[model samples]
Target: MLGPVTTSDPLLTDRTPLPDGLDARLRDHLTFLIEVDKLKTVLRASPLAAADRRENDAEHSWHLALMVMVLAEYADEPIDVGHTIKLVVVHDLVEIYAGDTPIYDTEAGVTQVEREEAAAERLFGLLPADAGVALRALWDEFEARETPEARFAKAMDRLQPLLLNWMAQGGTWRTPGVTADDVRARKAVIGEASKALWDAGRHLIDEGERRGWARQV
Candidate 1:
């Protein structure tokens, strides 16, 4: 079972000393950095593509950033890859405090928005005002999914786990009550950003169903 969610390091709280000359902005930035390091401890439902253990939120965000970089070309509309990377990176930082709400977990999904909104306020507020607002805006943009960059970033967010699940030979698709049709319905957002990726992901889902890795409806 997972332990309690840790937003900050106990060791760092006691050991780290503020430099006398440091400005408030830099100090808050450093503090925020230390807090976010705990994101590495927040595990996701998805397993690593090459490992036996589950992947953590930090690893998931890093992978999504890379996906944005490599897969931006496939986006239905042109996107600023750099901005999209920022969106993906900021998108999940709330999980540091809110904890990961697995996409397929309907029970957990009930309060997901409330939990994440509160977490976003607490986590991003650790930064200096300007930086905090900027990062929070990026998070909001990602959630709204209105901009082209946000849409593409969200696509990467959805696609990453699908790829991992396929590699894991059903990953979350094997969850009880989950079916290939359900996956297609949930992941159809990929087509909103990239038809090519959605096509590929659909093929994986269909094949997984045929192989009995995922349930067929």
Candidate 2:
């Protein structure tokens, strides 16, 4: 049976002369890192704040990590900022293998969940055994959103693209068949973790509709 997952291992750091078996562990961990770098190549539907181009999965994850650091104060209850940051950073790593699914693409259907699970298995399995187990557990926690940290992390994840779409004058919102209601339905979880942030987000949605930047169904 697999042992309990641990976040720390000698494979994570340099050691003089290294321990027996350390080389194989280090190679496994390094291979995971190198493979996950493909996350930078997975383009997302949301554009960057600068509006010059679409943001990739790695950029989206980093931006959400910063939001966790800066916006934890608005969480519905006090939270562990570090844990939330970790959740955000690793939550999207599966996209490196699964590819991104835009929020507005209702036609993409339910198969995405299955695809991401397979991706998570392959991507996280690239790490050393313990590290792979730990990361897979973390990714599942974020997906479940059954804990406060996961909920708050999910709030930031939903909010980032909302802000971006607004910045782009309705970005994917302007895409055919997307509407204000669709955006709200996708973003409603923001209210679960942070009412203050939800209030702010609702105002943006209202403003977008008012400006005709986002269409109403």
Candidate 3:
């Protein structure tokens, strides 16, 4: 049982004093719980998966972090790669509550902003106030796609599945009845951050068409 916490509480450090107290750390823990649970549920939900499975949020975050490392050089604007990585990794923690909504699911439209906004408030608000605010900012930045860092992070998010789809020989594209043109239309957004990667992505999609792995939907 968590009992009353006094100045002598093990969680308290005498060397460091701050106005925020027990409530703050408890909030942080709640945030952690919400995010971790979200990670588990999002794992298998990839749009490119043949099985229509979702990737757990944690795995997806790691994947995006690695992409940030590899594609940082291709960004069109100035960006701190590490910060971009942080933005992508933690961006979807709220989706644990909101759930993964494939962009193509226009009929179901699971990706509504209201649901996500509510999820963000509940999930991110569970953290220490400062941390909650910071994480919420990162999540909002990724959603806004306005800042250089956010643009690059979103670009990576869009490109990764395309690459996976191509490499896996029409993993989700074939099953979802997605076409080369659709892929191009979707990924074109990456150009906002990195022209080089955008061109490369185009070339790859073109090649897939030539190879009969993709066609007009």
Top TM-score: which candidate number? 1
Q: Against the true structure, whose lDDT is highest?
A: 1
lDDT of each: 0.88, 0.83, 0.73
The residue-by-residue lDDT of candidate 1 on 1-217, one tens digit each, is 2233444525243476767898878888988888788789999999999989999998999999999989988999999999999999889998877889888888888878887888888888888888999999999999999999999998888999999998999999999999889899989999999999999989988999999989986
Model 2 C-alpha lDDT per residue in residues 1-217, reported as the tens digit of each score: 1122232333222433334665898877776776676788989988888759999999999999999999999999889999888899999997766678777775554567877887777778778889999999889999999999999999999999999988988888788987888878889999999999999999999899999988888
Backbone clashes under 3 angstroms, per model: 0, 0, 14
TM-score of each: 0.93, 0.88, 0.79
- Stretches of candidate 3 above 4 Å error? 1-27, 30-37, 47-54, 175-177
Please rank every candidate by lDDT, starting with the best.
Answer: 1, 2, 3
What is candidate 2's local distance difference test score? Answer: 0.83
Q: Per-residue lDDT for 1-109 in model 3, tens only? A: 1122122222222234444655768646644653465366564335434444545767777888999998798988989988899899888776666666665555435
User: Which has the better lDDT: candidate 1, or candidate 3?
Assistant: 1
User: Which pairs clash in model 1?
Assistant: none
Ranked candidates, highest TM-score first: 1, 2, 3
Candidate 1's TM-score = 0.93
- Model 3 weakest lDDT span, ten residues long: 1-10
